[model samples]
Target chain A: MTATMPQAAVGASLSPAAVARIRADFPILQERPHGKPLIFLDSAASSQKPVQVIEAMDDYYRRYHANIHRGIYHISELATEAYEEARSAIARFIGSPCSAECIFVRNATEGINLVAYSWGRSNVRAGDVILLTEMEHHSNLVPWQMLAQEKGARLRFVPVTADGRLDMNRLDTLLDGARLFAFTAVSNTLGTINPVRELCLRARAAGAVSVVDACQAVPRMPVDVTQWQCDFAAFSSHKMLGPTGIGVLWGRKDLLDAMPPFLTGGGMINVVRYDRTTFADVPARFEAGTPAIAEAVGLGAAVAYLTAVGMERVARYEHELAALALEKLRGIGQVVVYGPGIEHRTGVISITVGDIHAHDLASILDREGICVRAGHHCNQPLMEKLGVPATTRASFYLYNTPDEIDALIAGLEKAKRIFKLT
Target chain B: MRPADDLSGMDELYRDFILDHYRNPRNAGTLEAPDASCEDLNPLCGDRIRMDVKLHDGIIEDIRFQGRGCAISQASASLLTETVKGKTVAEVAALGKDDVLANLGIPISAARLKCALLGLSVLKRALKL
Candidate 1:
């Protein structure tokens, strides 16, 4: 593996010369809604696709749209090779040890479920403990809850500090009896970037397997598995400038070899018999039936685009946007922003007004052609802990600029007036 | 867009009555003299409220609530407390969709109607009326 990059190294910031050219690469950003320029700040929900990713998928379907691995024909071979190439691309993107370690699933939800049903069902015993955080997306929390219920195992939580970052001191306490520590590299709702490397080191000392959900982190920052030293990590393509219906679950090779296949179907089996059947190797064993071939190709293209621009540049750009967003939101005295202290937090920011409901706020914002997500964001437990029904979140991405941040502030001001929040 | 009075879509749903109730909620505190009190939540959207009904001689003498949630929920609770203040358990049990609509002074979306009706429904179940 590449020499472990400095964990806190701030790489080369994007040159002013590069910003205009990079913006040109995404065609959809040129679109307008309500006769106003589009200001997309919901990338945490799903990222906008670049022209390269769109063209790559279109090229695949137009040229060689054939079922993979089973066909003897030329087009079939090409399709199979393209699909496998995507797996390799994803493997390299995350700095996984081997291409075979990358298993493509439906989404991060399904990827985590695979671990829960296959690995968790077999390994988690009645007295075991699964450590989760208070700020996980439902994808990471529910699976473990189900596992704990069925296996009679206990589900513990690492509490979030008042500033929204994970309280590692609490994590140290919870690590004592935990067999699995499922943590998110970034909080989707709070925008808090967790200290994953440090957390993983603690989990290792505690004799627990570490699983990092990088669905939000991979899009905003550079994620290197070798450096983070986690046993497993999962991320969705749609959240990271890639297509929907394609996600990657990267795990340690030895662990992958030990865990049983998650789904049972044709594509994953090596041999079949009436009495017994043999499953394929690490990845194929988990991928059941026909896979999301074109989506994977699009994701590969998305990774290529992010690489060309550089993840460090992406992180720097998003951090600047987050700071700008925070400053603007703080200026509105009526608005209360959650997750404020973490310096390395992602571009996402969740907020609520003094008395106005988030739904009312979101509806008013939508009228102005600004898109923001207003709900629990699939983190209901976190909402309960925060003592709020819901919060409106505006998550930024690579295409977002300072002007858009200004517009958001202006739109929010308008919302306050419309809702009589002022 | 239809005139603000038209209330064609969600605009009709966010009525002034609801906004008023949300702003100045009645029975906003806990009811300690309650025979039964059940806290319910719409776990999907995290709208939670505790209902307190002071039932005396099979009649709702007083009712109050104490919880935090969306405007729709808080407004609904306020309207419910107002509507069922002196009504019998049987009458409150008969409170249906139309009554809730009339109280809100506008129609609610299918998703939010549940939030508007959560307190009433749970109260009905608790009273067995």
Candidate 2:
């Protein structure tokens, strides 16, 4: 897969020049918010698309805009080819065995819901245990809760340790007799990178299916689904420098083959009958509507861009940024940063300064044109565990710079001064 | 770093009075054996406010609020407690979102509207109960 990608000359680390070039590709970076430079530190929420991705979608719409699969026209054939090629590119990006195993949905939330509705409904019976973690986003947690409630299944959680790592000591007991185990590859709130391969192997040994919420991981680091050996993995394109309205659910070939279709409509049927209809195979069966045509094309461009830049470089650069951020945040006595140590975490940093509300702090930062996400971050359960109403999150990506982080710290200091915390 | 000119807008939003209300909230604790009480949450930030009131002859004799949230929410809650105390339940009920915004003095962005109005919502619910 690496051989197929057009790799650029990437260094052991993303040099300042390399990062500056990457920043130039994103037009949004040029915009001035509140007459200040737009310092986007919210890539974990949704990343800004590069010109490459934007142009890809624009080209698809301008030149070859047509419905896929059914049309026999030239543009239609081209559109279908582009869409399927995007799927293959994404499949290779994630190291999936086959492109057919990749099912495109609206987002990661829809992907999880598809599994809970289709695979979970069939495999999980009453009183079966579904294993989850306390750190799961609402997307991963709510679907299982819905499934458990509907099927009368019991849901168990792997506790988060005090310092925000998963308490793996209780994993054996929790995985015991579990029907399925779904967990995040990275904690969106805590920035804790879970042991994906080990957890998957453990779940397999326990005779339970494994699902990985790769929403945060796929964008930040190198994620090989095959290497993890997880049954299914989901991630969103929007968080990975691609357009919104498209995400991937990479599942095992057998699992996807056996599972019933999630949605039923045109383009997903093999044979339509007056009374009953047969569904299409695997990926096609899951994609029931017209699908996100241009969005998929943009995602492919995003994949190409990331591949050229290299995931290893992105991960290393982001790790450095997170380290820098953690160091600076530590200097601020009022700041209480959440999640594990920098060694155990990625670039996502959640924090609360003094008794300052996350919203108030965020408002102050926004005025400085520093974009950070405040509030529960869709992990209310984790917030409850951390005993904070909300935390202001500053997540980094390949395009972010250390200067932006310094700006964030300065903004935090200003917020403290304004609230008279100084 | 940019000049603090950008933060001038923040000064108005987090004026000294609002911060004062947030830091040393008046009538901060709950009341024992309250005649009416209600709790509500601003789900956006998980900011919660519970309003307890002692009603006598359709009047709010005593009012207190307890909450955990952002400055806008806590300050608004504190300000609301002071405003509604010793007022008729009907008068307090007549207080609308505009009244809360007016009391805050500064213009509230749409994002923080829920935070600013959470106290009023809780108080109205408490009186109704």
Candidate 3:
């Protein structure tokens, strides 16, 4: 909440000193990949972990390493406290009233699959419509397709406009008779920031459940599930400066209680009878095995780090960063940036240069140690919407600066020159 | 954060031959009356290629490939067309990832090897028919 950075100087609000201090927190940012300074623009794919997160997991392993819960021993009790407190920390960060409503899964993909398998089967039936958007990551889209196919429900998409924003004018028709409305807070490929709050309310008005995939949004902006009034939200820890292999799925308590266990095993059982077996409650029932104990500790640290940095400042800085990158990229002839205009989007920018394919641009950038993401970004339907095979994306995060954006522009210019583009 | 003095690191990988093949790909159209045809994709990048082989008396009279992908994938596909044009089905069947990589004449990193060998996969699949 201590976001006192200047509104106009959003581009330089993170003062040279402040930027240096923030960059110092992340050890990997100091690394020189391929003997070149690392300009990591692929944070949308996965953010680098700060030393605080690294140390938290290391401290847990060195000191209180034990299986959580069902333990009376001191180390086990401490481990349980760390893990459970991480759940509480995440709940507080996202404005969930209760930590018990959060379920720890492998990643966003697994979390989406869990909901599709558990809730979709029970709530959705034949002739139902599971509505999605064209810009959804494969994680969010493929699961519903499989579930709808299995349940004989029809799959629908809210078309993305040529500007890359969702076609919100058609929401009434898309949400008509829909069992569920699944969407992303931000388009990872096109950088479109959808009206999440309005969309969720409309889904509610249309008598549909809203499931928001905030995998990209939570890291860059302030997301309050209570404010959005969504039924479920999912995101990955790694994308938020934590370690991989751990993700969070927050849902209404009553809904999770009603759904069956996603994966059945020893950890999630209440009784081991051969014939008829009972199950545990809510979060426990959903988390089916030994969980990512250290990764959870690291996630706790990551949330802590973001909290200290202030989400508003993070959002403001990234907005300026996107604006800066878009301005430069657009100046170059033949460079067409996708997604909504600068003010309407996030730090994610996907672009296409004259005849240079995305992979070729990405490879050229790699030579300069400026990491970017290319290809369809797992958004093939969105690719079809954009009418391009693939695009080069430069996604910014809190740690990125204007200088790195300059490097990206320079690298791109070199790519144009090397490829003989006028 | 300047780009290296020269793009030597990339220039070595995007050799003139590879770029030549990429820009002006040879045997890049579908063939009619093909004896055998097969398609495969580099699932990681979504780069797909389809190979059509017109066999005459157990010999490959003509071979062509059609697809869209990265330069390495398209060049590899174009190069494979030339390598297999006058060969027998048995000869083409024996081709593998190494032969394709060597033909491309570049040190392909582990990650991009799939792009380099995508055409070999299509050809091997085609020769099986």
TM-scores, all models, native as reference: 0.87, 0.96, 0.95
How do these models rank on TM-score, best leading? Answer: 2, 3, 1
lDDT by residue for model 2 (A123-154), tens: 99999999999999999999999999999999
Candidates by DockQ, descending order: 2, 3, 1
Regions of model 2 farther than 4 Å from truth = A1-11, B1-6
Backbone clashes in each candidate structure, one number apiece? Answer: 0, 0, 0
Q: Model 1, A215-315: lDDT tens per residue?
A: 99888888999999999899999998899999989889999999988889889998999999999997889988999999999999999999888898899
Of candidates 3 and 2, the better by DockQ = 2
**A128 in model 3: Cα distance from truth in Å?**
0.8
How much of the real interface does each model capture, measured as fnat?
Answer: 0.41, 0.85, 0.32
Better of 2 and 3 by lDDT: 2
Candidate 1 ranges beyond 4 A from true positions: A1-36, A340-342, A419-422, B1-17, B29-39, B50-67, B80-129
Query: Model 3 — interface RMS deviation?
Result: 3.4
What is model 2's DockQ versus the real complex?
0.67
